[model samples]
Target: MQRPAYLHASYRYGFWWLALVALGLLALGLGLRDPWPADEPRFALNSLEMLKTGHFWLPHRGGELYPDKPPIFMWATAASIAITGSVRLGFLLPSLIAALGTLALVTDLTNRLYGRRIALLSGIALLSTVQFALQAKTAQIDMLVTLWITLGAYGLMRHALLGPARGWWYLGCAAMGLGIITKGVGFLPLLMLPAWALLAWRGKATPLRLKELGLGLALILGVAALWVVPMALITTFGDEPGMAAYRDNILFKQTGKRLATAWHHVKPWHYYIVSVLPWAWLPLVLGLPWVVPSWWHRLRRLDARVLLPLSGTLLVVVFFSLSPGKRGVYMLPTSPLLVLAMAPLLPGLLCKRGLHWLATGLLALLGAIFLVAGVLGAAGLPALTELAAKYDVTPWVWWMLLGVAAAGLLVWLRPRRGMLGLAAWLAVFWALWSTFGYQQLDQTRSPRDMMQRVVQITGPSAWLAQPDFDEEFLLQAQQPSVHFGFHTDQDAQFLRAFDWLTQAPGERWMLIPQRKEDQIACADLSQVNDLGLQNNEHWWLIPGTAFASCQGDASAAPLFVAPTTVADAATAGYQPATQQDQDGVTATPEDSGK
Candidate 1:
């Protein structure tokens, strides 16, 4: 089959237009600051190895195969490294591109299916979304995974509904498979593809056979196997011992690891519900009564466009709800769906009284919240102080405060504006503070900063320790010529592996943030040379005598902040239960438009 000229031409040049725009915005969001983490620094180091060593299959750094995620981000980043010779820039640029790809996908797909106005708004909303904004630029694979999933969803739907372009269907399958490899099991969105195709084809019996779909799946699986099979085989040769452990981490444990549930980050299913409220505010929050009204109108007139978004909203929330663990940002992928489901139908959704309320009353409500929070922040400092004792006032809380004020201003300026007002306000709020303010509030910067700092002080052989991926700063700072934390040791990841926390500090070395603050086995802070500082937080964190000889436990004072006592982690809004390996119970999801 000779490919048609128009389709190829339209996409070849046109796709880049969208991609370029997405790329530009991505760069804007990430700016010049280093990556932030729980996950990003490790991702950065993984790619750095792919660059430094020129090995694609086995991701090793300092000396170990890294495991938190598969190699898609690393491969993408590594490719960048080959061209630019800069590891951080290489890894970051691709993820930024991928993240932008998502917005482009959202805009074009929705625009083709719906209209340009709705498509534009949805894309902007997705890009501007609080969580999406942060994740897309942070050099983590989750955004890439999200990009793959979203693109796959768009491709899958277009193939199933618009018409069967076998190529498009195959691409959908391929994208999904990559998505699976990118983050494990997220490829399951493919399961819904056929049913959607059926629905799109108006229930027509057709030649879109399971067998052909099987081939497409095979193609995706094959690409994945190329990477997996080699890594698996080479791992047995002692090239990648962690591969076996990672296989378990990826395949069974992440989903099934419940034996004593080594981690304690689990939270109640209501976690997202409570978390989203602050971002959503009274208009959306108190607008709960309106969900029935919105659902009722859609039901009255079976609108496919409205239903599509509603379906996405349901699937995203329901899928996560069923998961054993929860993070607020997990629901971020479906943010565009929320706007699509509700905002478009506003004119139709409002009955006489409802219209009046959506116009006048909602503004009034937001006004009240803005005034109240400000009054509370200024006047009720005592209550806030007490609350702060329980929960360190996280950056998100302040962001929410700023968002509420911005939302109020938007509403006051234009009550009938709908989501445009919401988007504008949120954008203003984040732009103002994300660079300077949020950075401070966030305790963990990506290990890039930490990595760079360590490089300045110590050469390759300085012994170091890392309790977790906290060494992101160190890696970002420079390539290791010698052994150090995050790469040197990952055993500190297990809460029980406290022994791994012990390390010898060299005269010139300091521990990466991930390393335990305790004394290194043979080194003393008293014996160390000062290396000046790392960006902001590292300035205050002076190295000390080895953990074995510390006057007080390091946890009492972390390398950066005045560390809290053991009683603090739980009482101070950090949920130990939130990290539980056990799955959270599923709750009945609230109706979509609501």
Candidate 2:
């Protein structure tokens, strides 16, 4: 079974080209845009708050403890921001670095197990997959956690299949501990142990002693304690109001309860297998027809290399699937191992004409769709124009789309090299989207424009309060603003906001979501200024005068939590709304245009 000369050449030099393409695609959009929700802004803000308040152990969002997950990712983001001095640059660095790290580990491990050609193909497969590329470009915890898990798997695999390499096993355990701190699911690599145990039972692999397992467990706990123990102590004994709740919620609720009785993002057990794999694992999914058969053959011969990663991947899928809650990203930890399992077969499968044509057809279809959409958008097609209007982006975005489409089509012309062409098309698509697309959509995706307008209407001297505010809104606020609470009910938030508004009528304003406008019984709606739509929600600005028509309840005192810099608050002469200003105006006309 002699590999072709061209294949060997590719194996020798393919890694560098893969690295270059990855760097260009993933890092191209760094610092060009603000973090877009539903997760990016929240994490970015967490990091920013960490840097601002010097509270790295307990993450906060809008001045309140954010216990939904541990602070490892935030710590990484904060460190990046501290070094780079730019949130936009710092926020995405961890994910980008993690992605590269994952790639290197997958490639190197695959090389050791299957040789260089399979390794190169493995890296290419990972980079070209929709899930991997999407998560790499996203500033989410999933990708960073994925890196840690992959490192753990790499070390464990090295020890299990390659040797009784104690050092590598310990490294894997430590990495998994780090992963746990990054996200709760970091211990996922431990699932690989079952396959290893199966091999041991069959007299095919080295058995880990009870002492070795205990020590590995110790290492994992020891690594996680680097953050957890300190956090637990602080939150337990600290004078902070919500520290106890934060500790319990994070330690128990977010981990075990979140997994078992999961409240949100619920889906059927087959969600990942059906909805996710079809598209998210693209190009890789296309190769499964060949990979499954090869894997089965290898398994029948009791090949430990094939058994370890394949079993681990399936175990992870089943682990997440059994849970009532699911998200496409939750299945991310399985990708690296899955790709490794498929790597050995990719060399043979890729040479098949059917696979080549499939690759070519996919690229062509994608290219044609984008090219036609771009042309129509540029010509002011109603549907495209409406979409642009909805996002509040200029038609220039379509021109950029046209350029990307043209570039992709150019690559697709080489039908013989369809897989390579497909990879090339993806690189072009990511690079353009990261740069031009990021800039074009930043204004609409972010709350910068809306917050700037809020500051303008309220004046520099006026303090602002936002009730039921989102993370992006608070992140972008120029004024020294206060939020009621992130999880507070809308009615309670409005009541407290009304009470706060009456305290300093002329010097303070309230920003409320338009959807919740009906909840403000104390405020005069006619005097509520419209702040227009931002982040797909209309916002209304309420002057102090808007609340003068009703009497405030003494019980509804404001719970002002300020997330903005204290120095900025001081510079703006912003005081807590509890400090009433006697000499304040009672009425002012609503000026929506302002």
Per-model TM-score on C-alpha atoms: 0.67, 0.91
Off by over 4 Å in 2: 1-13, 394-413, 551-558, 565-594
Residue-level lDDT for 354 in candidate 1: 44
| lDDT, residue 130, model 1 | 65
Residue-by-residue lDDT tens digits, candidate 2, 1-594: 443334556456788888997887788777667778999888877877776678888999878889898998998987876675455567889999999999999999998988887888888889888888999889999999999999999888888878788899899999999999999888898998888998988877777667888999999999999989999999989998789999999999999898898999999999989998788878777777777888889999878887888988999999989999899898787789888888778878767666666877887777677777777787888988898888888645555564566455556455656766677677777777776787678878987767767778888678888888787777767677887778776667777777777888989888878888567775788988898877888889888878886565535534756665322322323211110111232111111110
Predicted candidate 2, C-alpha RMSD: 7.1
Candidate 1 local lDDT, residue 282: 28
Q: Compared with the true structure, what per-residue lDDT tens digits does model 1 show for residues 267-342?
A: 6666666775346332343344666577678645645455555666667766666565766656655655565566
Cα RMSD for predicted model 1: 12.8
TM-score of 2: 0.91
